[model samples]
Target: MVGRLRARANASMWVAPALILVLVFIYYPIIENVRLSFFSWSAFSPEPRPVGLDNYRALGSDPVFWRALGNNIGYAVVSLVFQVGLALVLAAVLEAYVGRRLRGLLRTIYFIPAVISITVAGMLFQFLYDPHIGLVNRFLGAVGLDSLQHSWLGDQDTAIWSVIAMSQWQSIGYTTMLFMVAIQRIPAELYESAHVDGAGRIRSFFVITVPMVREMTTLLVVVTISGAFLAFNEVMVMTGGGPANSSQVLGTWLYHSAFLNDDMGYAAAIATVIFVITLAASVIQLIRAQRRRVET
Candidate 1:
């Protein structure tokens, strides 16, 4: 009995620090945000005034909020396509098509962008997109395609896409690396057997590689979706959700509501919505994966 007690105590001691941090940083803040969402307050307010669901109701009518949500959805779609889908293709090409001698060098080159700091990447893109004396515009002029050049970050029509492009460039390599690891873990014997059966590379990829990497693909999808919803830094640095709020996504909108607009209650409501969305997406993906595992 004493030995069991000592073991339990040691386990508790090992876990308590992490548990305390989660409660303080994650759980407590989530609960408090929910509570705050029920009230109205500004940073200068003496006390938060209970307003029930007024903040939510306002969100329903707020065009800016709708625009932000739409932009986030756009981000999610683009991330799934460029970050996840492109990564999968690149991984397949590297693992299957590339020669052994060049694969390592190519992987390092591809992953270099992922290692760059987001702030620096954003700033770099900002410089690249500048209309006057910027590389992009200069290149367009050199190619005799001057009509395609504009203030990439200043125009409302192009700003959000510009931000999304930067995000994809920075993140695609990380996703590709993950997919490459998944591909490597797949049994080489499967491909060998497929080759014996006269399966071409394309057919083998669809029949063997696709099915084998299903779980990793789903994981990357979930992560990309979550990241899309939480995206702030690129948007903030590149456009400041600017050109008249055309590039505002949920994260930046939330920040604007709290700090710039001083509407703490509304910001909390926005945060709650984002948490619910990300949580729901993650839960759905996990449940689907679990179901697939059971079936297979």
Candidate 2:
């Protein structure tokens, strides 16, 4: 009993640092933000004043907030389509069609952008989307589509989409790599059995590959959704939520309100909303994963 107790005590000591860090950095900020949401605070002011639900009430009438929320939803949808969907397709094609020798090279090429910092990617895209000197407009003109070339980042209609495209470029390869890893783990005998059953590549892929990678697909979906909501640095470096706030997401809007508009209370409310949404998504994902584990 004494030896067992001492061993468990040593294990507890090893975990204590991580537990303390999580409490201080993660839990404390969440609690503080929640408390701050019910008050009126400005950076210039000496202290926050309790306003109960006034900040949240103001959110209901805030058109900018609504626009930002819409943009965030749009971003999540786009991320799902391009990041998760495209990555799955790419991984499938590579695993099924591409030769083993070429696959590694191709994967490295695709995954390069994922390693590049988002700030660098944002800056690079800014140059690419530049109205006068951008490669995008240049390519359009080269293809004799001059009439179609508008300011990519400056136009409200195209600004958010441009950001989405950049995000896809930066992330799709990472998603593809994840899916590829999962796909590679699937039993090769399953593919052989399908082939002996006279299944074509396309049919085998649908029947054998897709179902096997369900857990990876679920993980990517949750990650992509959370990333879409938490996106900030890219927007900050790219649009600054501009072209008249058309590209604003909840993250950038919160920054704008807190620092620029000096409305920390409203910003806290926005943060709380974002937290609830992401937390709910995480909880749902956890529950679904647990159910899957139980069934399996």
Candidate 3:
């Protein structure tokens, strides 16, 4: 009995450092942020004054906050459609149809943009969306679609969507690679058996490929949704939530409030909202995975 107790104690001792790091770096900051949300503070202020729920109350009436949240939701939907859904299909096609050498080359070509710095990608796309000399407009003019050309990023209506398109261009490749890895792990014999049973490629894909990669799909969905909510760099770099805050997302709005507007307390409240959303997504993923395990 003593030996078993000693072994358990030693295992805990080995885990202590990591546990401490997580508590200090992750949990402590989260708790601090939540506590800070209840206070009215600014960077210029000497101290935080307790404001109870005022900051959160303000959020309820803030039109910009609602617009930012709506943009985030739209971003999540588009990312789900293109990054998760379309990437999976592309990955499956590449894995099944392409030759090995050619597949590797194509993957490298696709993944190149993913490895590029987000800042660089943002800047590159910004120039591409410029009103006059931009490649997008030039291409439209070249193709005799000159009437369709407009200021892509400068226009209020097109600004957010243009940023989203840039993000999809940079991210689709990375998601495709992840899907390809998941698809490759599926057993070959399952596909062969499907083929033997007279199932076509598309039928086999829906039946075998997708079901087998459910875990990966779930993970990617959680990540993509959380990422969409937390998106800052691309918007900041490309539009700065600009042309009169038309493209603002939650993250940029938080930054704008905290630093630019000198409303740290309100920023903390926004942070709390982001945390709740991401945590909910994670919880949903865990519940679904557990239910699947139980069913199996």
Candidate 4:
């Protein structure tokens, strides 16, 4: 018993550093952020003044806040459609039909954009969306589609969607690769058996492939939604939440309120909202996963 206690102590000691880091960096910041949300403060101010729920109440009345939240929801919806839904289909196609060598090459080509820095990607797309010298406008004009060309990022109507399009280009490949991995894990014999039973590829995909990849789908859904809500760098680099705040998302709005506007408390409230949303997504994922485990 004494020797077992010593072994457990040693194991705990090995874990202590990581635990301490999480407490200091992650948990502490989360707690501090929540605490700060109830106070009115600025970086220049010596101390935070307790304001109760004033910041959150202010959020309810803020038009820009609503606009930013709506943009986030829109972003989430688009990501779900393209990044998760379309990517899954693409992954199935690549896995089921493509030759091995071609599959590897295509995956690498697609995933290349995901590896590029978001800042770099954002700047590249910003240049591409340029009204005057941009490749997009240039291509449209060259192809006799000049009527379709306009200021892509400069206009409020197309700004958010333009950013979202760029995001889909960068992200779809990564999600497709993840789905492909999940598909690969499925037993080959199952596909062979389905083939023997007269199942076409499409029928087999729906019956076998989709069900087998449920866990990956759930994970990707939660992650995509969380990331959509947390979107910042792309919008910042491309639009700066602008064209009259039309493209603003929750993250950029939080940054605007805190650093630019010197309203740290309100930013804290915004942060709290983001935290709640992401936490809820994670919780839902966990519950679904647990339920699946129970069913199995």
Q: For model 4, where is the 10-residue window of minimal lDDT?
A: 284-293
List, residue by residue over 151-245, the lDDT tens digit for candidate 2.
99999999988998999999999999999999999999999999999999989888988889988988888999999999899998999999899
Tens-digit lDDT track for model 4 on 66-122?
999999999999999999999999999998789999999999999999999999999
- Pairs in steric clash, model 4: none
In the predicted model 1, the residue pairs found to clash are none
TM-score of each: 0.97, 0.96, 0.98, 0.97
Worst 10-residue stretch by lDDT in candidate 3?
Answer: 125-134
Instruction: Point out where model 4 deviates above 4 Å.
Output: none
User: How much is the lDDT of residue 128 in candidate 2?
Assistant: 97
Ranking by lDDT: 4, 3, 1, 2
* Local distance difference test values of all predictions, in order: 0.94, 0.94, 0.95, 0.96
Q: Sort the predicted structures by TM-score, highest score first.
A: 3, 4, 1, 2
> What digit string (tens of lDDT, one per residue) describes model 1 on residues 1-296?
99999999999999999999999999999999999999999989999999999999999998889999999999999999988888898999999889987998888988999999899999999999999978999999999999999999999999999999999988998899899999999999999999999999999989998889999998998999999999999999898999899999999999999999999999999999999999999999999999999999
- lDDT tens string, model 3, 105-214? 99999999999999999999988988888999999999999998999888889999999999999999999999999999999999999999999999999999999999
- List where candidate 1 sits over 4 angstroms from the true fold: none
Q: What TM-score does prediction 1 earn?
A: 0.97
